[model samples]
Target: MKNIARTLASLLALALTHAPSALAQASCSSDGTPQPVAIFERFISADCEACWSDAATPAPSATAGAAVLDWIVPGKAGDDAPLSAAATSDALARLQTLGRKPPVATDVHTAAIEATMPARLRVAHGMPFNDYLGTAIAFTPVQRAAQRTGAAPAAMDFYLLLVESVPAGTEGTKVARNMVRNMLHGTLDKRNKLSKSEQMKWMETRSMRIPEGAQAERLRMVGWVQDAQGRVIAAAQSTCR
Candidate 1:
């Protein structure tokens, strides 16, 4: 019996060593991420102290199926700015992408995720480790969308966001926020059809750095896919366990 137990343990260890990477890490909860029908983005400058605590700052809808994101654009004050530590260049790029100038204090934008879009986007992340988090996003084309004959491959832009959920009162703010801390971007061309008539999908897995002072437990991920026209096709937000 001792020898049998030893053999079983050895087998188990060997199996684990060869396990798939996905199996080695946790994904979203069993219920999966939120399927947000609309995305709301709030922009604030790190140098603006009043903006952080202002009650007029726009907020995401309380209605279900909506996702809100907060971006801290780097202020002209540079590192000396109050919230400079949380400011990111990605925010600036996003402003450019949206054709919006940086606001002196705060601004808001909204985009809808078409419920009838033919593609699906899923985002997930594993538990944080070593100041890094494993995150992934996948794009899947429905049967008809994938089987379009002789159609040009569609251009797709993928965005994965790592956000810190801050309570309304935590930072003297009157509203809760999903603060964007880190981001990953990629582009893909949709396949005209599934490979060998099987599943055709685009996916990317990456390690996102956890910013200093970010509470890992409060971290979550949001992702969306945009077409060439910059319309959101699908959006998802992770639910951390």
Candidate 2:
């Protein structure tokens, strides 16, 4: 069973490496600037013995341009007590909205491996809410010339994420990577359709409580845009000032 899983994972890795998309390319602009990336958020429980491997998975370098968020929750598949109830609830809501099953250790490996891929959109000018109340994300439309040669979707969905970089964790254990504290979802204006002629701006703000264990200085805001099919178009991250 382990061998089968390993083989499948390897195949998937190969596919992602060669996949052609704005997100899969090295540079999205003629000037050699990399496009913004999508956020890779993973949900897990500390008590789940199977989740340790994933929690230990290292994050992609900042140069990769992917912001990873890890949500630690408590439940049947989670720990006896979550590090932050607000964070857990936020993650649960996102997974439910996406109709995805609770993530296991393998999912973490998948996210880390996939982080190397390019992103379809770029996240720019991200900022945290005043008083640590929430975060604001700006969705800037991709330039027509920079976009992949394909029909643009009539509309897109946007999600705002509050992420904490590496936080204090148990000694001798794999360090927890990016941890998502909250998320806010929104849809772009259909009339605007994210046209390249003018950068269609979609902004979102989400209020959240930073977990007790999180380092306030390490907080970040991530913004991602997706199409109607739930395909990520672009993503970006910014640190709290």
Largest lDDT belongs to which candidate?
1
Q: Give Cα distance to truth, residue 191, candidate 1, Å.
A: 9.7
Q: Clashes per prediction?
A: 0, 7
* C-alpha local distance difference test of each model: 0.75, 0.49
How much is the lDDT of residue 43 in candidate 1? 92
After TM-score superposition, the amount by which residue 229's alpha carbon in candidate 2 deviates from its true location, in angstroms, is 1.4
For model 2 the TM-score comes to 0.58
How does model 1 score by TM-score? Answer: 0.82
* lDDT tens per residue, model 2, 1-241: 5445444433432332233242233211111334345456566654454554445554555556555677665456333433324336766677676677655432442222222223343332212223333334444544463265444345667776666666446422366567676566777674433344544444433344455555666666566666666666565665322
The worst-scoring run of ten residues by lDDT in candidate 2 lies at 22-31
- Which residue pairs clash in candidate 2? 23-118, 23-119, 36-122, 70-178, 70-179, 121-233, 121-234
Pairs of colliding residues, candidate 1: none
Clashes, model 2: 7
Top candidate, metric TM-score:
1
TM-score of each: 0.82, 0.58
Tell me the lDDT of model 2 at 115. Answer: 23
